[model samples]
Target chain A: MSTATGLRRLTPSSFLLFVAVLAVAASAAALIVVYRTGGGIISDQERAEALAERDLLEQVDVEQGLDTLAAGVTRRALFATAGQHFGLFDARGQALAGDLTTFNPEFRNADWKVVRVGVKPRYTVHVIGSTLNDGAVLVVGRSLSNLRRFERSIFYGFASAVAIVAVAGLAAGLVMNFLILQRVDAIANTAERIAGGDLSARSPVADGRDPFGRVGVSLNAMLERIEELLTGMRTVTDSLAHDLRSPLTRVMGALARAMHEGATEDERMDAVEVAHDEVERTLNTLSAMLDIARAETGLSREMMVRVDVAALVEELADFFTPVIEDAEQKLVIHAPSHPVIAHGHEPLLRQAVGNLLHNASQYAGEGTVVRVSVEENQDTVDIVVADTGGGVPEDQRGRVQERFVRLDPARSSGGSGLGLAIVAACAKLHGGVLRLEDNHPGLRAVLEIRRV
Target chain B: MVEDDAEVADYVAKGLRETGYTVEHVPDGRDGLYLASSSSFDAIVMDRMLPGMDGLSVVKALRAASVETPILILSALGQLDERVVGLRAGGDDYLTKPFGFSELHARIENLVRRRAGRSVETVLRCADLEMDLLARKVFRAGKPLDLLPREFKLLEYFLRHKDRVVTRTMLLEQVWDYRFDPHTSIIDTHISRLRKKLDEGFERPLLHTLRGVGYRLSEQP
Candidate 1:
């Protein structure tokens, strides 16, 4: 309902959000994999080291007594190692012997787990404890700072990756928004120009593969059609003025003569008659122009029905036959006996075909033959009126089909010059085409309509 | 008369007066409605567009007030479907503008005569020509005359308006119901043929062609 560019409503920010979410998920997955593999390696190694120390202490305790084991030189060697610590405790949980006994002892019995014990620069140590048979306790701890450092590095890297991906997605979204707005603005500006009466204005076409390009093509086509219609309207207006003004002027001249003081009664009567004739002629011209306008605007489509083209053409031929024969011309008709139906308004079709036949009668000349034929194909029915008189020049045939474009001065006397124009309009309204072609010795006017 | 244009109203009123009919003209729709409802008249000629109210509204209001005087709507918008709208708005008849005065006068008289005759009549006679409505038969001077269906309808219209001028347009509209004009002289051909049939063996010609006006089927001529 807003008629605004839909780009803003379906904004590019949502796409940016989606990209950001995917980046976060991928970064999280990488961090989790790194943490699990690295942590597992360090924990497994630390557990093995603690188990070996515990086994050593248990063997020494079983083979020798707890006091003898604590007093052995091997116990000192174990405590003296670089990344290992050992402790011996009595049943009161006091460290009897170890390298560092100054740490607090919060120990669990018979378990292997990591413990943070020291105050400054705390060491995350994986420790194992066992209870000897003589009510003594032994503990072993391993340092894990190297593994922790590696994991911290991986975490920082993942965090920065997520931040960079999010920023890049936002920048891309902004650029896309700018491009879409530019294209939309171009279309709106072109439409505004066209609405302001610049019918020649058109939108710049984009690449054919993109939606914007297709939209531009369609908009340009619409503008072209509007321009054509506007140009046609101007032509019709000018022709109407030129056609009606002459008759009106003649009427005025005749009336002026009748009103002259020196005119005799009989002369004034003749002038009155002339004035009346001119008035009628002007009215006829105006009416014909109106009819053409009406038909061209599709006002007659509301009266559409199924019309038999063959029957209609035959009837028209019969009606005009006597009239043509009376004028000393031969009238020939050729039509199918079967019904060839089309969707149309009967009166409008009649008027269109009648105009063509009347043109033939008037312009085919005396003693010449005018032939009307109805030909039906799969989808169309063509009613053709051909005459054996002086035909229109090939170059002027197109112009003569236009309103008020009379090619023959001698043939232009009685007609308002809208006969063919009306026929063409009617044919168009009925979803058909009107063609003017050259007969062997005359003109052939064909009005083709869609069959029902 | 209800019309906005002074020239048109004056011209129509003068023509009606020349034809020996009393004329009264009102300029706009409001006063026209007021006078038509309060007084009695033979017929009212109303224009479609007026200063106060439109012709359709005025007709609707009068008909609502039970004013049965015949109303003829005159409009400049003569599209193919416009006449239907005018008649649907309670107008007795609709005539488009740029019309000949004879056609207008004939239509107005027809409307008035139609209003005056309330009861249906089965037989119509103009001088020696008699037509039976139910039998579809015509007798001229007590002699049966054969007529085609179209000729019969044309004669019926002529007999209906025996002493008045009926224009070619009136005939086309009343008989064939064609609103658009034909470029050929179809009506003239039909009329000439009908004239030959009616006057071929008759003593006096009842159909008279008035130059510059139209045809009349009357005994006085």
Candidate 2:
């Protein structure tokens, strides 16, 4: 691997190791402080004991006599405890009445020092010496093996602590790096597969309990939306081809008939008119499709204004009343006494409501009563158009909202099969929905738009 | 007319000329602006997309230069706000592409007639039919006719542009204040009902349907 990647992988582990090193250094400093203080305390106690012993022997010499002092030293040395010792020597450096085997002339006037005494089993001692009368010397000492043993144990304890901390830090760092890299790799693999044209691939989301899992869940949702759009686009293209082709073929046939040499002027004119009507139909279909696409994009949201929806619906009801009456159907409008207002693109809202009314008039059959009502809720406004005619089945409600989907092929001749689709798009643009419901014996299309 | 498409420009010029209009066409926006500012015409048909300069810029430049000739913008862009943009850029009217010649002709005629500056009249009369704009009433042959508010508005528009071709889109926009085209013959039904009220017992019919084109409210056939 490149040095960059290697450094990246080592970053977390290295940071943890640095922290461990800091901890070890701090602990070592503390241990050294304890060791030094303990050794100083031990040395002070040993020196005090040696000084007291010397003083006591001197007192004996002063109170009793040199002979008595010498005898006392001999008695104490012969029955000494484990960490006690004494020595008495003449000025001539000769051992007198103590267990001290080796003696030096320097010991005659030594106040305090550490010396080695005895032969076969050597002993290290803290000693104090003083000159006595009649050219004699006395020494007092204590063994220092206990202080050495304590210092050694402290050193070993600190060394073991450092070892344990280093090992644990390394292990934890490795485990953390493994877990992070595994999660990252899983996400990367899923992304790579999707980029390689596998749209079905999704990042594994065990749960949304952690940041990584949340990212995976959202990523999968995004992929699902993308796939849905792609499928929708495919369906649109296929339907567009099938729907446009038939009308275009008819137009071509009419034109061919008009261009035929044997055709009379009247025949030619009729053919031309047929072609013209077919082309107009095709243009209308194309424009409706464009309207639906534009509404879906919601690009004209900047043009939204506060529109009195009830007034608009009333106006529409007025506009469609004559036509519905001509069809032998009665039109009724139920609107609030006050203005029902909403924020929306007025033209699109009008078009959506107009489409619903047109749909009802076209399919509600003769003698059916069409009702147009505007109802205001807390956060939404619904413009409903219901007709007492044969209604769409529940299963076909959702399918009818799709582009170029017609429930009845017989009723498809006059429309582009995109009326409800445009209405749905317009509803979505307004942050709402178009719901098709059963009005007992007919269809009730409610176009709900946000109040804002 | 300022247009870049040769066939479309030819077709429009030919149709207007056949209708007794002295037609002038320019394929470039700068030239169209120069000609329009330099000369006077009844109306100008400006294409939105043109060579050398865009149509909206030309319209703005002309308006800035104080050329007050009425302009009708022709655009392939049929977006909802595109018409508003064109009108806001000093255009008197907006016509989407793939329009019928009669629709274009009717719009041009309306533009020219509007430029003629008829004073606001309280009452509009076409033969025996009369509409009182202020009173919101209509009378045929000196007898009062009961009309709904929408029907009154529709008749008022027809009387305002009497003896001229009025397309369905025009009526939808002028009378109903809507832009979307209804699939059914809703306009036809409305007009037929109004015709029943206006010409039901009259000796001569005034509202005549110009088959395959539109309707014409003329005293003569």
Candidates in order, TM-scores: namely 0.72, 0.77
The candidates score, on chain A by TM-score, as follows: 0.65, 0.67
**Tens-digit lDDT string for candidate 2 (B132-220):** 88888788888999888877888888888888999988888777767757373788899998899888888999999987778988899
Question: Candidate 2 residues A1-452, lDDT tens each?
Answer: 79888777767667777788898998899899999998999889878878887898899999999888889999999899878878888778788888785786657667657777777798887778888877887888787787888888898888888888778867877887798889889999999999999999999988788999998999999999899878988988899898899889989999999999999999998998888877877777777777777777677787788999999999998898887787788999999979887998888887888889888888899999999999888999988999999999999999999998887877545688888998998999899999999999999999999999
What CAPRI-style quality would you assign to candidate 1? incorrect
Question: Model 1: how far is A232 from its true place, Å?
Answer: 2.8
In angstroms and one decimal each, the interface RMSD of every candidate reads 3.3, 1.7
* Residue A225 alpha-carbon offset, candidate 2, angstroms: 2.9
Looking at model 1, residue B148 earns an lDDT score of: 71
Candidate 1 lDDT, A318-435, residue by residue in tens: 6565467666788889999998889987766777888898888877789788989999888888999999888888898888778887767764466788889988988898788899
True interface contacts retained by model 2: 0.50
Top lDDT model: 2
List candidate 1 stretches off by more than 4 Å.
Answer: A1-114, A117-164, A167-171, A181-185, A188-199, A207-211, A218-222, A256-267, A291-357, A364-398, A426-452, B64-66, B79-81, B118-149, B180-184
